[model samples]
Target: MITVNAPYAVAVHEGNDFTANPPHTSIWGLLYAQVKQADGLDYRNILLNESEMKLKPKRKQDEIFSTFMQEAEERRAEDIRLNVRHPHKVDATAIMQDVMQQMTIEKHNDQSAFCVWSNKEVQEILELYGLPVDSSLSILCVEVFGQVNNTYEHIDDFAINKSSLIKNTEKEFGSEVALEYNRTIDVVGPQPPKRPIDPLNSHLGMHRILRTSPLTEVPFVCCTD
Candidate 1:
């Protein structure tokens, strides 16, 4: 592919939300090499790729880390399981969701941002250029497949359900920031056959303000991917 073989091309998600990915419309300046060297190794071999670090090493820990957007995922999952402090837990979840909504970022400037599904930018590309760019919900399903508890039970139903998540997230954050949440999460599903999105030798963040949040701040970048 053009991106994988380029001198230094890399695919990076511009936001911190679940479906965040690159928009189709923004002109990416990175060369194929950079994308290949940087974001290339990401989806090479399913068993040996990003999922290896995110799942096999410590499945449970990884699950907790990813389920709620990391950092707070574990505690949130535990809280849900135990049903301890029900009122407080519910309140905390609301607060957390709100915080995350406020934390989702958008890609407009050149400070090095990310892209996602359904962004105005992507829709523009699809409408204007006819490129196939993934939506945030789809991308999230692709990258974090194992993180969700019942993905298999209804993996086929994600696209339909994803719209619901988008609406809920938008309502949670209010209008001013809803766009960012909508832009960050990609809904990758319909459970299509897994094909190589990007080729070998590649690679691939956060903040607050909803507007002020930084999406490229990756906690850990594995050497393998």
Candidate 2:
């Protein structure tokens, strides 16, 4: 989770499929923590590409978007369960609901989110940043990207990988039927991005993995010497 710390600024791209919810703190949290440690990272999160980074107004908008993401995640889980035996993963819905209930009265009113991380995570981020692992720092920014689905018109939702998707669907769903829909992904030479400046609305959420600072103090406070 990098704070606003860079001179020119570098994009921290962080994204994943729908499954890793109720959000994995590791992804975004790590980035911010490392970046913050590096120092001078400034960013206008809610604004850019001619959009205003107005937090208050977008709170509701974020809720709407977040709800869609939640649904996509749930639907994805359901689809996965339909395919393979569930590994007894924690019930995200139940956990979220329970977490909401357990929040303090003031917190409940304010609607805050909780993020928890562990030692190993901090070490991993340190390694990424080319730092010797010594867990101690804080003051980071967190960015998250959840890729629940894609917008590719041709690729079937079920068949994500082109070759495997086509072959498998053809075997189960039938080639003739699949062909009827024209689901072939045309891999043309890299086309110039639709818009050069902000292709894929990269400015929006989840573009960059978070560059964050360590989540500990530089000098230790171990009591017993």
- Clash count per candidate: 47, 42
Give the Cα-based TM-score of candidate 2 against the true structure. 0.25
Deviation in angstroms for 215 in model 2?
A: 5.4
lDDT, candidate 1, at 140: 12
Native-referenced Cα lDDT, model 1: 0.32
Worst 10 residues of 2 by lDDT: 47-56
Stretches of candidate 1 above 4 Å error? Answer: 1-25, 32-71, 75-97, 100-222
- CA lDDT, every model vs. true structure: 0.32, 0.39
| Tens-place lDDT digits, model 1, residues 1-225 | 111110112335675333222211111112110012246665321111111111112124334334545435556678778886752233445555555544343122222323222245434544453333331211111221212234323333455666776688778887666667556444432354533322112422211111111122112222321
**TM-scores of all models?**
0.17, 0.25
